[model samples]
Target: MDRISALRNVEDALRAFEEGDVDLTEAERRVAATLRTYASELDGEDDVFRAVGDPAVDGRVVVAASAPAARERVLAAAGIDPDRIDDEGDVPEFDVERV
Candidate 1:
């Protein structure tokens, strides 16, 4: 499947798990597949999508350091415009002033 489709599937699986509707094994399988596909689509040599402890609705892949910078990096790595990743609703947002 395409990267977007894989991402959506991963998100859905995580949502199901978070809501207590899916099991750990199923979630893991979906996450692993999604990560693999995501990594394959990475055009940047240093791009990496490391999984944090868990997934959430606002975000699935948590950028490892400096949330704002990481957010931009994540967007860039995913071929998305850095200006498009929404952070208004997420806690510890992508706001540079708060970083």
Candidate 2:
């Protein structure tokens, strides 16, 4: 699936979690892990997506990168194979200001 679709899936899963449609401690954790893996698949090396805590309920995961493309790369690099990442998102802007 494309990046937007992937993100949408993540959002959907998050919504399911919020609604308690899945067990927070068990199924949610698995779903969260799958989400992390999917994110990593899209991000590849440019970004880092990892589960930071236990898989149990409330476990936190972080997705970060120096560049948005890299973040997508991290997702592209998921250990598990995933659909190709289209890298679809507005680029971030960085400007230097003199003190």
Candidate 3:
């Protein structure tokens, strides 16, 4: 769906929660579903990627034009400096794969 429609759908979910029509958990589920739908339907060069390997950045999903950019995005999302090392003094390794 378009960005506007996505926002509207999320707003409706929030409104339902506010009006007590749905519990918080259900509202959260609806919002998450909307986001997943919106992200998956992105146009152009962007594609969804999943991070794997190290636990710190594992399972993170990011939308990027390429795997490298997705790796950077996942690190940023996890709030870990790309150059930072782990307790073992090794830079955390993660591979970004197309979803």
Q: TM per model?
A: 0.35, 0.30, 0.84
* Over 4 Å off, model 3: 86-90
- Pairs that clash in candidate 3: none
lDDT of each: 0.57, 0.45, 0.87
TM-score, prediction 3: 0.84
| Candidate 3 structure quality by residue, lDDT tens digits, 1-99 | 889999999999999999999999999999999988888788887999888889987888899989888877887898867677557755558798877
The clash numbers for all candidates, in the given order, read: 0, 22, 0
How large is the C-alpha RMSD of every model relative to the true structure? Answer: 10.3, 14.6, 2.1
User: What alpha-carbon RMSD in Å does predicted model 3 have with respect to the real structure?
Assistant: 2.1
Which ten residues in a row are the worst by lDDT in model 3? 83-92
Q: Is candidate 2 or candidate 3 better by lDDT?
A: 3
Best by lDDT: 3
Order by lDDT, highest first? 3, 1, 2
lDDT of 2 by residue, 2-64 (tens): 567656776777787788886567555755666666655663533443332222211233345
